[model samples]
Structure formats: C-alpha cells, structure tokens
Target chain A: MINAPSPTQSPSTTVPGRLETRGASRSAATLAFAWRTALRIKYVPEQLVDVVAVPLVFTVMFTYLLGGALAGSPSSYLHSLLPGTLVMTLVLLTTFTGTGLRSDLSSGVHDRFQSLPVWRPAPLVGALVGDLGRYLLASSIVFGLGLAMGFRPDGGVGGALAALGLVLVFAHALSWVWIVVGISVRNVSAVNAINIGVQLPLTMASNVFVDPATMPGWLRPIIENNPISFVVTATRGLMHGEAQLSEVLWVLAIAGALLVVFVPLSLYKYRTHRS
Target chain B: MTHPVIHSQGLKKRYGNHKALDGLNLEVPSGGVYALLGPNGAGKTTAVRVLSTLVPPDGGAAHVLGYDLVRDAHTVRSKIALTGQYASVDIDLTGQENLVLIGRLLGLGRAGARRRATEVLERFSLTDAAARQVRTYSGGMRRRLDLAASLIKPPQLLFLDEPTTGLDPRSRIELWTLVRQLVSDGTSVLLTTQYLDEADQLADRIGVLNSGRMVADGTADELKASVGGGSLQVRLLDHEQRDTAAQLLGSQLKAQPHLPPDPAVVEIPVIGSEAANDALTQLHHAGIDIISFSLGQPTLDEVFLSLTGHPTATEELA
Candidate 1:
C-alpha cells in the first residue's frame, strides 16, 4: 500500500532528540520499541519461577543424596560435588525456553504480535534476553545452596565468580538450541518429550555425577571432552582451590562454538516462518 | 486527486498448494468504509492480512498510506492498525492496561499513553469497565477494548476483519454505531464480513468476493439493483382456482407464478410493484378473487444467492 506521507504528518519531530536520535544507524524509535517489548516481560513472572526453584532443588537433592553415594561422606562429596550439580541445573532450566516459545505460538499471542509495528526480531530477542535474569537467579541460588551445605571454593572470590559466569554463558548458548527446537516442534508436550530424551542421555553420559576417570578408558575421552563435562570439571576444579586458565578457555570455547552454529540457525528458521 | 489509501495489484498468497488469495486486486479510497463481503473460504481475511502488513504476499504489489507493502512495510505498519476476527486482548491485563500498553509500544510517552488510553476507552464507551481484567469482560466489552487498542494513536487507516462476527444482535448494533462514528471522523476503514447486514449498515462501498475473486464491486444500491430492483407478490383465495388464476395472470400481467405447496391458495411474483396492481385489476376483470398483496426490495441474501450457485453456510472463510 504506497502513498507519500502528507507534509503536515511528520510526527517524527514530536519525539525529543535523545529518544529520536541514537548511536546505531537504525532509528532510535526502533530501539525504544524493542525496549518496551522487553520491559513488558515484567508481568510474566510465571516464566521465571521455574528457573528459580529448579536449581535450589537440584543442589539440595544432590548434595544430600548423590553426595553420600559417590563420596565417602556427604560433607566430603560437597567439596567436589556441588559444582557439577550446578551445571546440570543450568542445562535443565533451558527447557523453559522451549515450552515458553511453544505456548506463546499456540496461544495466538505470536499471531497477535505479528500485526504490531515492532520489529520481527524484537520478540525473539526479548524472550531470550528476558531469561537472562532467570539464568542469573538460578546460578546464584545453586551457589548459595552449595555454600550452605559446607562446600567451599579453593579458588578466591574472583575465580569462583568467573566459574559461575562460565556456567551462565554455557546455559545461554544452549538456550538458542532450545529456542530452535521450540519453534520447530511448536508443542509443549512434544518439546518436553524431546528434551527429556536428549537430556537423560547427555547428563548421565557426562561427568556431572561421577569422576570421568571412574569410567572405562574408551568412554573416558568422550566424557572428558563432553562440553557439559568440561564445564563441570573446570567449575569443580576452580571451587576446590584448583584453577587453570586453559579450563576457563575451554568452557568459553564451548559457549562460543554453540553460539556460532545454533544462533544463526534459529534466526534463519525464525525469519522463514513468518509467524 | 490523492492516491487511494490502499491499492493492490495482482495480490497472491498461497499456503502450500491451497491458494488462500488468488490474484486479489482492490483499491480503497481515503475516508469512509469499504466492505469486503464473502462467504467462508473466499480469502477475505487473507486479503486483509496482506493489506494490513501482517502477512506477506507471495506475488503482488500494494501501497498503504503511501508506503510500499514490501519494501516500506514498517512505514505502512506505523500508519495502520488491524483488529482481526478474534478479540486479541490479553486476558491477564485489565482493559485499560492493554490499551495503554499498545500506546506505549507505538512510542507514546507514559503520560501521553495513559491519556490516549483513557480517551479511547471513553470514546468506545468502555470507561466504566476500564479497570476490570479482560477475562472478566463480556464478549462485547472485550471486542470494544480490542477496537480501542487499535485506535490509541488515531491510525489513518483501520482494518476491521469481521468485527461483528460472534456478537449478539444488540452488541452487533452497538459496534455498527461505533464504526459509523469512526468513518465520519475522516478515518478510512476496510471491513470484511460474511454478514451482509453489517456491510449494508456500515459500508460506503461494497466489494463482493467469491472463490478468491472480487465478483462485483459497487455501492449497496448499485449491487442490489444489478440483481433486479424489487419484487411484487399476490396470494389467491382457493386451491381449485390456482391453475385458472396462474394462466389468467401470466397472460394478463406477464408475471411468474411462484406458488407454494398448500391446499388453500397460490401466489405470483413480478419484478415491479406496478405489476401487482395490474394483476389485481386483470384478475378482478377475469372474475378471480385476491387474498393478499406485497411489494418489497431484494435483500442482500437474495443478491448473494443470485451471484453464487450455493448459499454461504457451507462455505468457509480463509
């Protein structure tokens, strides 16, 4: 539909310079529109609830149950055990994105937003970015629960904080993959079934619950190099007074590599769907 | 003259092999209501979606408010608001909150958005129920809130796709009044509906679409007249005299006998009211008695039946 805007209809000048003019080549109006959409997530507290409680449950359950089973004593296991449980909790919480995305699409909110003036990428980016607070909250509670169970990091405050940061980045990276699955499958039940199928094999196969060395030699390398296992091992090492520069790089590398593949694939699917 | 507010050339949309909109072309002039009338599966909604910038056309060119549909889609969206068949209000938010949220999303400041929301709520007669959650609202209130959300920024063009679809009779009349009020204020409106009465009540011009094509486009009177202006009918007294009267009236007044199955009497139909009066004099001169007589305009339902081979109930909308 193209007709030139009437001379008297220049509403752009009505916005103040600070809101209308911006650093990015894109119009500031576009940016503020995206920000408003993101801020609307404040009313959606249900999405954040799962993120908060899952980590606390996992940390407490594992510290008491798996800790006594794997290590000689529950307290002794807390030293080496709390780090892996935290990583597992982060991965478990990524399913929220898959379920949330599917619910939004099926409930017709996605179609409703399609008619709005907001950018196509705005909703997708907002949902992912909004979960950043959830990820942070989950990570903090797991660490706090671990500390309450008498688990102390051998690394200083900076090293422990860096290790927690690594887990968060990895979780955020994997979230893109879940976002793709959510958009593709587009059903909450289907997402839950598929995620459980993948998660069971991946978590049990990694070093989240036990030492990779305890496994047979052939399977050891896969577990040692399993990205989840690598993050878990590095985090455990850092918390117990053993820190290494190479381990940090490995965790960051896994996050960066997943970002390289899944983010573009998800965006490509998103752009194509037209929903 | 200024370009039409909406213009489309060869608009085509396909969902897999099923063609939702097959080469639809429409031009709506600025101001007044333009109604898209079609039975279900006629691609009316698809056409609205393409024009409103909600769905991309597979092949075509459209311009809305001087903005190209494809390349200048963002500009087109900024100038237009679409309220689809279903009420898209968020059940979790209050009616006022939904309108205010949409205003802010359109880049209105907090104070301005709230003020606009209040104004639109009052304009739509929803001021009393503004604080209630949308889920608690009646069907009519929810639909009114949906329309108010679309009007927060005073969009130059509005797309109302079946705005009266599920409303009860009273609610439908209320919405019809609101639609008239909006068009009178210089806002151009494009409305799509299967209900002929809605179009008759609200549209300045009507376009009838069937099987993904516009079969006829004209003012309501023009379309009605195209199918024959009016009808005249007369009933007779006795079943025994039905055949006798049919032959006499057919020869005397040149009207068809549309007799219904009944033991008592018969009826005849003619194209004009004068024909009935002519039949009365002719029948009396021929020693026949008349029971009743009537003159009336052809309804849109009759117009639809004349144009399409079948009725609309079996057909579905896109």
Candidate 2:
C-alpha cells in the first residue's frame, strides 16, 4: 500500500551520507509517528474490523434487544441509545491505545525510537492522533446507521458533528490513563487483560446502556458519579441539540482531570520505563 | 585534539541484583570505529544502551558528542543513532515505509523522505523487498532494513550493538565495508561484538570488557601486545588434581587459569608481567604432574584470554 514518491535511482552504491536535512521539529516528529500508526491499518486489517463491527453490533443489539423493554421501541430508543453507544464505542477504542503501546514498548523498535533524535513524547502523542481517524470512523458509522434505523435528532448534523468532536477529545484524554497502563504493564497480554477487565465495568456500569433512574438505588448514585456517565450524558445532550451546560462542563472537567493526572504520569512512566 | 565522540566516567547500571554496568568508563575518539569486544553477558549491550541515551544510568555520567548525557540528552540524541542487536525496524510497516518514516523524523519532507527511502533501498539491495512488510522479510533482510533506517541521516556518532550478529558471511563482509565507508565519511561508531576478527578488521581501537568493566583497551596490535606473550594450555593426567594444579599455577604464576570444560586441562594466560616457566616449575615442585603444556600464539583470542582469562564465545563463522 506504500508508494515511494518519484523513486530515485542511484548510479553507484556508496556509504550513508552527510545529512541532507536538519533535525525535525517536534510537531513533525509526532506527525511522522502518527503517519506510521495510520500505515499499520493496511497490514492489520483486523483493527479496522473492530472499528466497524463494534459500533454496528452494539447499536443494532442495544436498539433491538434492550430498547423494547427499556425505552418502549427500537426507533424511539435509538435517539438515546445512539449517542450513548457512540460514547461507549470511542471509550472502548481508547483501550486499544494501551494495547498497541504495550507491544511497542516491548518490541526492539522502542529502543530504536528511544535512541532517535526526535522529541521523546512524539510517538505516544502521534499514535493517539493517528487513532483519532479510527474514532472518526466509528462516529460516522453510528450516525449513518442511526439515521438508517430511523433515529432522528433534533440538534441536526452540526450537533452530531460537535458530539463527534467531543467524544474524540474524551477518547484522547482517556487514552492517557492507558498510556500509563501500557508503560507499566510487563506485556501486551497484560494490557489486553486489563482493558477487557476495565472495559466491561466502565462502559456497562455507566449510563451508556440504561438510565440510572431505572437502576437500583445504591447503583444510581454510583452510576451518576461515573466519569463515563458525564461523557455519555454530554454526548447525548450535544446530539439532541440542547447541550446541557452542566453536563458539558462535567465532561470537560472529567477529561481535564484524566489529562492532568495521567499525561505526566504516563510520560514519567515512559521516561523511567526499564527497557 | 578534538573531543572524543563519547566520554564517560564510572557509568553504572543495575538490573535488580545484576550489575549490567559497574563503574564502566569509556572514551571513543571521533572519526573511527571503536569496538567493544566482549562475550555474551559481558555488559556490552547495556553499555551501548546507556551511552545511546536509551536508558538512564544508575550512577555516573557521560558526554556524548560533547553534550552532557543527562542534562543535555536531547542534544546528544540529535547527534547519534543506535542500531541494537535486534532488527528493530517496525515489522508491520513495509521496508520502504520504515525508511520513509525514519527519514521524515530525520527532517526530510515527504518527497525527500520517499526519494531517500528509494536511494537507501537501492544501496542496501532491498529494492525488491521495499514494498513487502518487514515481518515477511528474512532475518538478513530485516537487519539490512534496520541498518538502512539508522542511516537515513547519518548521525555524528553511531552505536552498533553487535550489528553483524547472526548475519551470513557475505552480509557480514558487506556490513564491514559499509562501516568503513561510514567512518571514511566521518561517522564515529561504537561497535560491540564477540567476534575477534570483526574487531580486528573494523575497529580503530578495541576495548575488552569482562564482568561489566573494561579489562584492556588499545589498537588491535596494542591489545595483542598487552597480553605479553600468549596463553599456556596445560593438560593434567589426573582429573582430581586439577584444582590443586590450578591454584598452584594461579598464585605462583600470578595468573588466573581458565578451565575449558575439560576436567584435566587448564589454560593459564601468560601475561608479559608474569613468567609462565616459574609457574610450571612450581607445578612440578608441588607434585602436580602434567602430560604436556604449550604456549599459544598471540591472536585476538590470546589477547582476550590474557586480559579477561576467557575466550570469546565460539561461533562457526564462515
């Protein structure tokens, strides 16, 4: 899938050169890494499978299976379900950041990167940026499928796009926590195990599936305080046109807290990682 | 004289209880290959890792390319590259993509990166495999691509940790030639290898490492001369008396004897500072009978054996 632009021919084989270019700027380095992460999609098509299937399966399942009992009907329930499912989809996708980072940390490529003349945090940040494309794919799938299933939104396309942007931000912030996990874990399998372990409770226990009012009394407060709840509630509000200020602030606050806490923690763990 | 490419003082690193580097000091002058010759587990890789800024040292410090190792690490990183033992290119990426990625990181524009990648592929004879994922490449192919990635923009200094390990004879020869060309182009290299001939052929100077520290350092001829004369291989008729004979030769001759898995044979390196005949006489006086003894020639092995008291790891290099 890769094509070298205007491939050149060397007349004679010689040694490696006096450098033809200067050192890359930090942004350029990060962008290069992001380009690398994006390129991997070509080789590992299975990643694209998850990107498409998860939102498709969950949207169909939640609307048809649980929607009748919970929200009365499939079309009626999807209005609430579509936004929540998008939140869950993006949130779950965030875990993969850790999975990839864990393997990259163990691989010898990490050594090569560590010894490179680029910005140190470029690889991690660039991977997240590249992953933003996957989030965009998932968002578009949910919206497209939601519209196909006759789930209309009062807030219109701009609102849905705004919600898409919001969830992408949340995904990036949440990914930092996993970055720490990725750096701390001994192996890629451990990252996957923890991802699965945490994903179930984090996505399911939140208001993504059902309203907290329908949940048990003790679980209501627990769900209300969930960070994912803030994200889901804000996403739902943005998609429905009336963006609740409190929910939006809460979402921003939670994302801010995750970044504030985990960004440095992950970078520190990365710097001190015993590779 | 210009500053050395690398200068370190008492660099120390530990892995739990294992001291990977214990007060290791090194100096590599600019513009030539300086070989760190050691057996496996001799801390060669660890030393390279620390010097390349891939790992923070437990204690001590260094100046790589005249930049402070810890304080000015970014500056050090800007001037050096490391090709580790493993073929470290991204296996998931095509060989061409790996080079382009590295080229971009080295500050080339997209078209510049692609052109450089093509040039590098041609130079490394990897044009055929450039479009294939690195994971599909053979070991030699991966190694060449890894080396190509490192050379996208030749840093001021290069750290090659056993760069030719596991390579075939032809590839090894090709790599040696490349290293010479790089050096002639003024890229100082810190190379670590267990092959005596590799060091002799490529190194401007060699450092013998044993147990996380340098035992001797010099040019190939100087290193061989440092061993004094050579090694004394003594065979005993009695296996039970081997320890006694070893102790006799070690103390009396002031040289440690290496037992090379043969229960009845001990090789005592004859350093120039110490006399072997006196030890042989002492062995005879102490009633430790030997079948025969002979002095080995002053090859690179003898030099290593004299300094570290052990031979380099045996490999069937073609």
Candidate 3:
C-alpha cells in the first residue's frame, strides 16, 4: 500500500505500475490454473465420485457377471477383461473433460481467464494437465482392484507400468476431442449427452468387453478397426509382455492424429467463441 | 484537453448477422466513471468484450489506454482489467485461493501474491471467510471478490460490465461506494448498466446506446434535457382538487400537466430545480393539500422511448 502510485501519475504513465517487474512465465500461469483445479477437487470431494466409484463398479461387475461364460472361468476372464476395462474407464473419463469445460464456459469464469494477460491457451492446457491426473487416478483404481481379485500380469510390474503409460497418453490425446466439444457446445447437458452417445458405442461395440473373434463376421471388422479396440489391443499386449512395435506405433499414430486435428480446433473455438 | 483514455471509430461486430455492434463510435475521458446505458442485446457486453481484448471486432478500430486494440492487444490487456457480468471468481476455490490465482497470473511472486491476497481480502472484508470456498459466500461477497480480483494490480483502466445487476439495493450501494473510492484514487472506469439512475449517480458522462450505436451521450443533466426533462409528481390530499392543483402547477412550472389514470396524482415534466420549487410553493399558496411529492429523473424506458421511439425491455440488459 505504501509504494502505490499516486492518482496524478496514473493518466501520464498509462500502464499501472506493479510490484512484479516481470509477468509470470507461461508455465507458471499454466501451473497456477492447474492448482485451481486441484483446489476444486479438494473442496468438493464429491466431484471425484465417478472417478473412484465407476471404475470399481465396472471392474467388479464385469469380472463376476459374464466372466465365466466369456472365458470359461471367472479367474481367466480377469486376465482378459482387466486391460480392456482399464482402457474403457480412462478413455471414457476423457469425455468429462468436455463436460467440465462446457460448464466453465458458461459460468463466466472462462471470460475472465480469456481476458487475462497471460499466455492465451494456459487455461485450456492447464485443465488438460489436470485431467491427466484424474485419468491416473482411475487407472490406479482399476489396476489396484484387479490385483486384489487375483489378476496377475505375465509381464510383471514393468509390463503393467508400461500399459498404464500407454493408457495415459491415449486418454490425454482423446481429451482434446472433448475439449472442442466443451468449448463449442451451447450447454453442459449437451456435452454430457454427447459424451454418452460417443462413449456407449466405443466402449460396448469395441473389443473391450470380449474378443472380436467370436463376433459375427460383419461386426468383427468394425470392432477391429475401432480406435478403442486398437488401444485395448495395445494395452493387452503391454500387460502380457508381448507388445508388437507395429501395434504400439498404431496407437501412437491415432493419439497423435487426434492431437494434431482437435487441439487447434479447441483452441480456436476457445479464442473466438461468441457469447 | 488530455488525450482520452479510450477512443474508437466505427467499432463494428456481428454475431451471426445479429449486428451486436454496428459502426459504433465512443470516446471516454480518463479518471471518472463513464457509463454505457442501453437495452438488452444493445452491444454493451460486446463493446466491453472487444475493448478488453476478450473478443476481436469484425471491422473498425479502437485505441485503449493509447494502444491500438487489435495490433497491440497484449499491451492493452496488461493495462486493463474486466469484472464481467457474472461474478467470474472460481466458486470451488476459497476466496484466498481466487485472489492468489489472479495475483499470481498478474506476475506476483508466491509470497508476494499471498501477502497481496491477505491485504485484498481484508480490504474487501472477506478475511473471516477467506478460507471458505467461494460457493459458500453470498452473491454480494462473490461480487466483491470479483472486483477485488480486478484490482489485484490496480489496472490503469477497469471495465465493469453491469457489476451490480442482480445485487440488492444495499449491496448495490456498497458496490457503488467501492467504485467511487477507486475513481477517487484515479483508476479510470468504463461501466455499463441498464439502470439510468445508476448512470446518473455514478457517471461523469453517459452514452445511451440503442441497437449497437450510441444514440445520445453527454452529462446526466444534458441527457435529461434532451428528453425534455425530469418530472414532478404530486399526490393530492383531496382527489377533487386535482384540476385546480394542475392549473396552478402548470401556470407556475410552464409545462403541460399529464394526468394519468390515478385521479389524485398529477405528473408533469420539469426543466429546472427553480421552476419545480416554484410550482411546489404555488400549490402550498393555493392551499392544495399535497399528500406526497417526488422529483423523478427520466427512467431508461423514457430515455429509450424518446431517443429510439420504443420502450426498453423490462428484462436485464447485458
């Protein structure tokens, strides 16, 4: 308060003098917004309800309900279903990124962030960074439950860790598609509905819950070509210690393609979106 | 005169053919409240958005705080702050965290941001609730936090887009007091409000907007004169004496007396305080007992009807 500039000097100087001689670095601003997201989760622990509960429910329900019929035994089904459900949980969590963003856009908070002098994309990028942590949480929950249910990986801890890394990269890239949806959509429910419409087909119709081999001929190609199925195949390979470089490269290409296309579209919509 | 803090020519913006801002021009001098008054959908928020560099104009040019709006937008953004219509503070974060976030973004160090946040929370009387999430705070508290965020660095120019739109009368007055203090410290402010009384009370000059263009602009009194003038309303003690009272008041005020459906009330436009005073005294002298009297400034509805030939919407603008 003591060093505050007097009123007479304001108009002449134009720019209001500040205590901080330099602006915050782009990384610092991004981290600051990430801190905001963390604080939000801390205050409203209920926001993490779906992250924790959904994964637990899916892991238990699928392993017990249809595991015996699908794989000829409940325990054996855990071997196949664990990796698939892990992909399903995290990849589906990416949809929430759009729903969160859509609400932020309408909350008037987005306008304030946009008006800031910091790096322009910091807020959106910061939110994406926070979503990475959420995906990590969901991954650990599914993996932790499977380990407790007598599910063991052939590749041991190293293979499981690699699988987790692949899921994160893929889920992180997929969030951009939802970020565009969040920014361009008019309301929150629309983002939610779109998430369900997109998620149901990808999670159910793909090779996540069962092998595409037993499917009718026409359905097999769709499941095999599905990107989620590619991610699942990549995940199963990593966890079982038999990962093919071509499969790894394919998953990388799909993730890279999503980042290349939707990242620009999301940022553009964020910058120019009309109220 | 010193260079105006804001000067723009033909500022145009269109939202899918709605023409939110259609070739509008504006100039606001530094160091006082300059209000933009208009009906809903009259481009008030759009103008604030464009000037604050949140949204780009489709055409036209603007200079804010002596920097070009489009070419030097980053410089302009550094010099200005905006408190949007919705209290833009993060509700899930505590008041302390919200202030710290804004301070850190504005370039303050960790310790410096915490210290500044403490001072700001105290100044805004939120120190007790600083640890609570903003969602727990009442509407007034949220708005105060929003304004506090805007003043984190004492920006050279502050844009307040309908700051007190939904606040109660007491809260509105409290916010007004805060704004007055900021102006006294010499922070130039450009505010928009749908209430004419708000503009009249706070603004040194006003621009009345209609359908994206500024239809009239000047001091409050000049605006009143442009729409004829303020009005004098008298509630009669006896409804039967209304005719005689109107005759006496008309002869004294020299304006046509407009008798509304209320038989006991007579309303007429008043140009000056002296004439209104004379009319009041004339009623007293004639022994026409008056139940109550009020000198009413022109409302936004009246202003719009006179300037644009239609009444403004009763709903919130901006």
Off by over 4 Å in 2: A1-21, B13-20, B39-42, B56-61, B70-72, B166-174, B195-197, B232-295, B298-318
lDDT of 1 by residue, A1-275 (tens): 21124321111111222222111212333443344334444555655555446546655677688778878878887777677777877787777777767766664556555666766666566666656666666677777887778877777687677777778888889889888888898589898887678864686678877787888999999888777888888887766657577887888898899999999998888766634
Tens-digit lDDT track of model 2 for B83-135: 88888888999999999988888788788889988987886778999999999
**CA-lDDT, candidates in order:** 0.73, 0.83, 0.83
Residue pairs clashing in model 2 are none
lDDT of the structure predicted as candidate 1 = 0.73
Residues B200-226, model 3: lDDT tens digits: 789999998888999999888787677
Give the per-residue Cα lDDT of candidate 3 at A68: 89
- For B156-262, candidate 1 gives per-residue lDDT tens digits of 78889888887888888877866766776667999998888778888999888887777888888988888885654556676677788888877766655545445
Instruction: Summarize candidate 3's per-residue lDDT along A155-203 as a digit string, tens digits.
Output: 8999999998999999999999998888788998898788678775777
lDDT of 2 by residue, A207-229 (tens): 88788998889889999998888
As for lDDT, the candidate ahead, 1 or 2, is 2
lDDT of 2 at B248: 84
